[model samples]
Target: MERTARIDTAPADAPLPDGLPDLAHLLDGMPGQSRRQDPQARVAPPAAAAEAAPAAQDRLRPVRPWRLLPTRLLPTPRATPFTFAYAVVLAVTSLVATYADPAVVQALQQGSSTDVAHLVRHPVLVLVGSALWIAGGVLSPYTLGFLLVLTALERRVGGLRAAGVFLCGHVLATLATEVPVGVAVATGQLPDTSLHRLDYGISFGVAAGVGALAGLLTPWLRWPLLAWVALIVGQDLLSSYDPLTSWGHAIALTIGIATWPRLRRAVSRTRH
Candidate 1:
């Protein structure tokens, strides 16, 4: 027994860890050749690397069920007619005013005392001339185009309803335009020679009417139209600065937007 113990102790420097499993030997071995390797062996993923991946990506990548909607559920186009008619009427009236008699033109252009006196004396002629102008102006290229556009729009929204909307918008615009002119005239800030027949008109107001119609008819387009109206009015106020030209459209648009709900209700009631 003493000789056997002596041999074991003497073999400490020799290779004596061949068959038995040892924790130090296993740890010192390369990972691939380690004795602990098995079918169930797994290395934990690095904590920083695992946390770096996006968790929400899986949820975000899934397709939505409603994305396959059809295109036919949309409103008819409104701009096609509205723009055409307004331009035509505005142009023809401008042309007729230019080519006619100087006195009549002056009477139309400047609402001065002298011009007023001249028109009063030629009331019949003025009325006849205005009538002809309206006829020609309405049929002229500019007015005709607008009429074509408005006519189509009217077809979509019944004539009476369209008229009401247009008229309401016009009234709002007219007030914006007329009130300023009235104030200017009263204050004598503008020269008597500068005022014209079209000064009190509501072109922008009509635009608001058209915008409102487009907005209400096409639900998705409503906010955009409102934004457009706001921008246009704001620019007009800031730049060209005509209260009526700049702010009239805004007022008309507001009225038109308000009227949209009522108009829709009325149309619904009528349909029933």
Candidate 2:
């Protein structure tokens, strides 16, 4: 009997188990083996999807505050004491005008020959009663815009200065436009019948208020407002319809713009 020494026959990379012989089984258990994909398993998205991912994220992201409800975009940001009172006056006057006898309302609005004659004589009180009076039944939009602009100004500057600006614009605009019409009637540029036109409305005051508010606004805002106002006035001028009202609005807006510097200073001092 002769003793036989055993010799090993295996690859250098893998040691064979004493009983191992199948390479196929070993290949199946390797880390790199490709298994049939489970239909539910997440796979990398296609190129198109990857490209759209950022857009989806942007849509999901919360909106920035500046892009949301900004204060600058809002009018009458909050109820102001002066604003409330002013609104009340407008509302009350509007109601009175709405329900009043048509004849009486017309008489009050158009300034009868007697009223105009008297107002012209005084000149001082011409804007007194008419400032709050809306010739056309009290409109909600008029009230709303008036309230917003007036409130914003009252909130920024004290009521006194706001009042001053309002009066300056209202009284000045009234005297400037109406007096001309009166003078025109006197001068014969317009018929004496024109003096009796229904000229009463908050439009003058509202225009002034809007002008003053624009003055307080940031430069970006101020320009747009002025342009918008200019557009309305320009349109009226070009169309050759009611040029007087447009001129009045322009004059009032100018007064408001001029008062801007002082209004700003007052607002600054208020902060201190």
Residue 263, candidate 2: C-alpha displacement in angstroms = 0.9
| Stretches > 4 Å off in candidate 2 | 1-79, 111-118, 122-125
Quality of model 1 by C-alpha lDDT = 0.51
TM-score of each: 0.46, 0.66
What's the lDDT of the predicted structure labeled candidate 2? 0.69
lDDT score at residue 52, model 2, on the 0-100 scale: 79
Lowest lDDT 10-residue stretch of candidate 1: 68-77
Say which candidate scores most in TM-score: 2
Runs in model 1 lying further than 4 Å from the true structure? 1-95, 98-103, 109-149, 180-202
lDDT of 2 by residue, 1-272 (tens): 99997654444345446895645544433454443443566766798778877876776677778874434333332535565676677678778677889888666665522134656665555467677675455665556667667767887886778778888887787668776677778877878777565555667677788888897889999889889887987887788777777787788878888887888888889889
Against the true structure, what is every candidate's RMSD? 21.3, 18.6
